[model samples]
Target: MRENREIAHTFDTLADLLEIEGANPFRVRAYRNAARVVDSISQNVAMMVREGRDLSQYPGIGKDLAGKIRTVSETGTLPLLEEVEKRVPRALSELTQIEGLGPRRVKALHESLQVNSLEDLEKAVDQGRVRELPGFGARTEELVRNGLKRLRGTQGRTLIADAEETAVHLERFLSGLQGVKQVTVAGSYRRRRETVGDLDVLVTCRPGVPVGKWFTSFESVETILSQGETRSSVRLRSGLQVDLRVVPEISYGAALHYFTGSKAHNIAIRKLGMARGLRINEYGVFSGDQRIAGRTEAEVFAAVDLPFIEPELREDRGEVDAARNGRLPELIRIEDIRGDLHAHTNATDGRSGLESMVDAARERGYEYLAITDHSQAVTVAKGLDVERLRKQLQAIDRLQEQYDDIRILKGSEVDILEDGRLDLPDEILRELDITVCSVHSRFNLPEAQQTERILRAMDNPHFRILGHPSGRLLNKRDPYPMDLERIITGAVERGRFLEVNAQPDRLDLTDTACQLAKEKGAKLAISTDAHSDSGLAGIRFGIGQARRGWLEKQDVINTRPLPELLKLLRNT
Candidate 1:
């Protein structure tokens, strides 16, 4: 069965190819928009198709696009995509996957120098021919080369969001099996890493149950790599490999601990067990072949005289020592979030209207929701000008009167210009409840200049938080050159905050960066940067990232109640 992401990828590829072929602008945008709508939706599109439901009712998916979605879900390939691939080399679409190479640039390269693939692009770069093209300079060529390197480095890893979708589906399926008693997805996935290389599933079942065989026969299984009574591995249609293992009920805890690990953390735990004249392995902790403890993770930890550590903290980054001293952090949870600080509506590129967004926030039991639409710098998103933004503020006031349950704060995702000035003037910024200043373009500035640029932006009294601070799109664009330590320190000095953007593709302020911010006594706001109501749920991903970085509820500003949060914003 095709996943929503697979279907979305199909439409995106078709759109990219159409654009490279200079097809109608509307035609290309329709497919691109359809892809966004499909990917962002939480529903199982393939199931919807099987049930004969209408996909056309979804946003950006009209009757024609709905038919294409059904065809791809049923047959695993889009006919239109095949037709387009024949006319334009499919490799060109892949070229667009490289950063700094949009459809227009790819077309220009193809038409001028016949650069059809990565290999051709490499050759052109090597011969210094690419820089001689109309818009390609030495700097642009260097960026392309670096982007290619980054792309290859992250080639096979799946984003955590995509991996979670697959893992959840499988876990639900396996839990329903008659004899299965426990199922857990281990490894970096359990750790909530930003990217997952593969999945490790541990299960406990009855002796006669054929769990491995059932796993290999899952509907989404693309290839059965190996199959057996106790263990099996299969490749899903999304190209993610999964390994399932069956362990005894007595050793389920030990197996889960062993599989869900960083190698260093496991080694440290094993050494601790050894000090007590015991041997530790997946089976259990044994003292001369007689099992001591293993029935639960807590039992295993107690054997070593340490409290059970959270999976996100099992990275051996002082966690073992912290556990020994009882200093483990009380990590932040999704429920601790009082409200979302950054969100957009139809006023910008967001899908829902203001009233609908307010209703969604109220349904979630939030005290406040900031309407931070894009400013004028991002013209592609139809960013608002001064007059338009003032109009939005007036509208927020009117909408606020209708809802006492949720306070709708006025805000804007203002653009931080390349030269350290803001896109919108200070007078207008002061009238708003909040400002999430961000760097939307010129991501290639040198380290000193970029650092200075943001530092200067932080000097503004109205600049509340640094949005997507690193400006990286995972597995696609690299973070621009900047001194993160200095930036964090600057934020601390200026009483500003850093945004842990919860968007799946741009979970900026990485786990390590989050840790660094905490070390520097800087605060963070885990906002969804949501473009639609469904996008609001992305806060879970940010929470996972925060836990991995050892953040607690007190360390996050938005976790505070509305009055305290407003005071903090005002102080800034």
Candidate 2:
């Protein structure tokens, strides 16, 4: 069956092709919005189709888009996409991923230079042909060159969210099989990196289970690369390669530790074992040919005289030294989060309404939920003006009376202008319980100007948190150039907090940056920046990032009680 991601990709391609073909703007937008809506849903869309449920009940999915979803779910392809691809090269959709090449430019390139792929576009730029086109110039050619480089650099990597979806489904499938003792997805995946090249799944099962064959036979397997009694490798339909390995139960911990590693962390651990006249590998820890400790990760750590580090902290970035010195931080967990400080409603680009979002947050037992819709500067999101914001504030006031269990903080994700001014004025910002300032335009500014721009925004007394501080979109866009360390310091000096946006694609204030914030005495808020109710679940990704960054309950501002959180926001 087709996954939600597959359906979304189909619609996204259909939209891209339609736009390139100069189809109606409204038609193109419908498909684009449908893709976003489908991707945001947490439930199995294919299952819904199989069960004959009404797909149009979903936000932004009209009757027409709903039918298309059903078609893709049942057939594993979209007829419209196939129809469009025959006229417009399917590969052209990929060119739209370049920073400066939207569908119109892609169309222009195709018509003027016959550029069909990245290679063709590169050749055209090299020949100075792209710059001679009407809308293209030397700067655009440079952007294409740089974007192509970044695209190639990230070619094989998959978003962590997509990888997680595949891993979880396969893990459950294997776990349900007879005699399967354990299944753990290790490697960069287990380390919770923002993006992964592939997946490594380790398992321990009863003898003679033929787990390898079972793995190869899984429904998603598109190609069986190799198979053996204890090892197997396969490529899934989504183009992600997965390797499965079976190990003895006694060596499970050792194998997991070895596989769930950054090479540096493993090497460090091996050095520690070697210093004690012990050898450590995937099998077990040995002292002169005598097996010692390997039954559990804790046992392995005890043998090396260190505590078991969390998988997220196995990056060898001061974690080992911290472990040795007994300074290893108690990383924050999802449960520690009391509220989400960044979120949107239908008043902006969000699909859900205020009441629904409130109910979802209250159901999650949050003490507060901030409604930070986009401000006027973000015109694309239907950003709210002063009058609209005031009306929304009044609406929140009325809605607040309906639910005593959660505080709905009236807020706006105000844009930080290039010159360092907040999108919304102070009078309106002061009325808000929180202000999440962000950068939504001019991403290519030089480092000094960009740094100064944010610092100037921070000078505003009402700026509480910097939302998605780095403005990175996981495989799609690189973080704009800026000195994060200086920004962290400036945030510290101004008592402003940085945000660890929980969106799977934009876990900004990356793990490393999170650690920098923690080190520089700057606090952080791990917010979902959710656009839909289901988007609230993205908090898990942020928690993983925060854990990788060595954040504790104290380092996160929203981990506090409602009153304390309010106090912190006010003080900022």
Candidate 3:
């Protein structure tokens, strides 16, 4: 958002996509390498340029890229980007959304077949035209065809939380084994991309035994792609692919450092390690003579004289440096989440009853899960009216007694009507455990109007949090314009928690804005905004974005334990 590497990587990635579409391998690598550099820098690239600092001073920022970064900074738009957008369907990047289709193939199809969209790509494959391409014979074409078929009508990318679910599942499986020392997720999944491309994992085990044997034993084993003493790749029944590597315990730290990649970050660390005469790889760090790490991820990092880095911050963007300087922001953990402040039940579109949603939360290790089904204003959603609200309150009382450990918070995701007032009556609002005011319609409002609409709702003391503050749907719709800074500032001043809607389509108070909220000393509530029990899984996605912002448990409102959460919510 600020023209830093995280921001630059988008453009650089776009550059690579164009290069791939342009079919220039070397240029693609250059743009990718530069993007990685932008991602790895600890300082703001855009800010540095404004100060007249040599943009190329950063390791990955070359003279050419320095120019590109400046253009983007000055205009908030890149001309090259516009040109590429015209030549390629910006959604062609969505082809990257399809597993097994790299930019080259995407470009190839775009170039060779005029396959502009998934629809066109599917048609080409079905017609057998895709089989005619170079290196793409019958089998590869069938693979592409199957991929499209499998994903047909799927409206959104797999949420980052979904990937984390798989990661946790694998972590549990591997951790349960006899010889395993530790397991962790690595790659972009660990970085918490809104939509993960695939899952990459790193595990540490005692050496002198084959870890591949353990890989063959997982519940969803489809086929082993390749296996060596240290690394293996495989597919699962769900069509997700995973790569696993075994490292000695001592190398665990460095192996994690390497595998939990912002590849740019890994390269930087490896380069730093190289200067000290250490070579690092997935297995571990190698000294001039010996294989030192036999166990533990910490020992590997200690070998290089740095503290261990968290998986989330491993994005080569200053993490190693942050590790070196001890400047890393302590990230929020799932354990820190006290409750989900926004959820629904059968009263609306939710698949289960309120108690069942609470049960799902309890089973997933939450202290409480707020049930905020639609307020009466959302007639399409069958939102609760005064009478139904009373019944829900009774139901909450019954459940609170029955499930002693889990607190059932009465709440509603009340629609913020076009007139900028919450739909629920004041009497009803006063009875709720939590009140989340949101914009479900009129997303076309202008920036000033949108900001004003939300502020009007925030003026209500009952507006405890604002849901999906931006009203965005990834790959589907961009959020309506709003003065985010104004909303966060107002929310903080009013002692209201800003909601980070975890539903993938809406990672609303996205990392950038969430970080801004923290900078402004605002509290955040990370809610699943879940519609089903499994929907609670979106909580991890919110948490991932929170971590990316370098959020601490203290920075989040829900990190309050159940008692603390209750007092905060009820204004007690």
Per-residue CA lDDT of model 2 for 481-520, tens digit only, reads 9989999999999999999998988998899888888988
C-alpha positional error of residue 249 in candidate 2 after TM-score superposition, expressed in Å: 0.4
Question: Per-residue CA lDDT of candidate 3, range 1-572, in tens?
Answer: 14343345467657656766675667676666566555434355666767888878654468887888777666566777778777677767767656457778888888899988888888898799988999788877876765675566454345564455557668877888877877787778777877666677777677565667777567566787887877788876545688887766665666665666778867776787788898777666788767765245566677678787766666665668778888878888887887788888888866567776888889887788788888887887788888998898888888888887777888888899987889988988898888888998887678999899998888887889888888876655556889999998998888888888888767888777877898899888888888766667668778888887778899888888888888887772
Error of 1 at 421 (Å): 1.3
Quote the RMSD, in angstroms, for model 2. Answer: 1.1
TM-score of 2: 0.98
Between candidates 2 and 3, the TM-score winner: 2
| TM-scores, one per candidate | 0.98, 0.98, 0.64
Steric clash pairs (candidate 2): none
Candidate 1 wrong stretches, greater than 4 Å:
none
Better of 2 and 3 by lDDT: 2
After superposing candidate 2 on the true structure, give the runs of residues whose Cα lies further than 4 Å from its correct spot: none
The lDDT, on a scale of 0 to 1, for candidate 1 is 0.92
Give the winner by lDDT: 1 or 3. Answer: 1
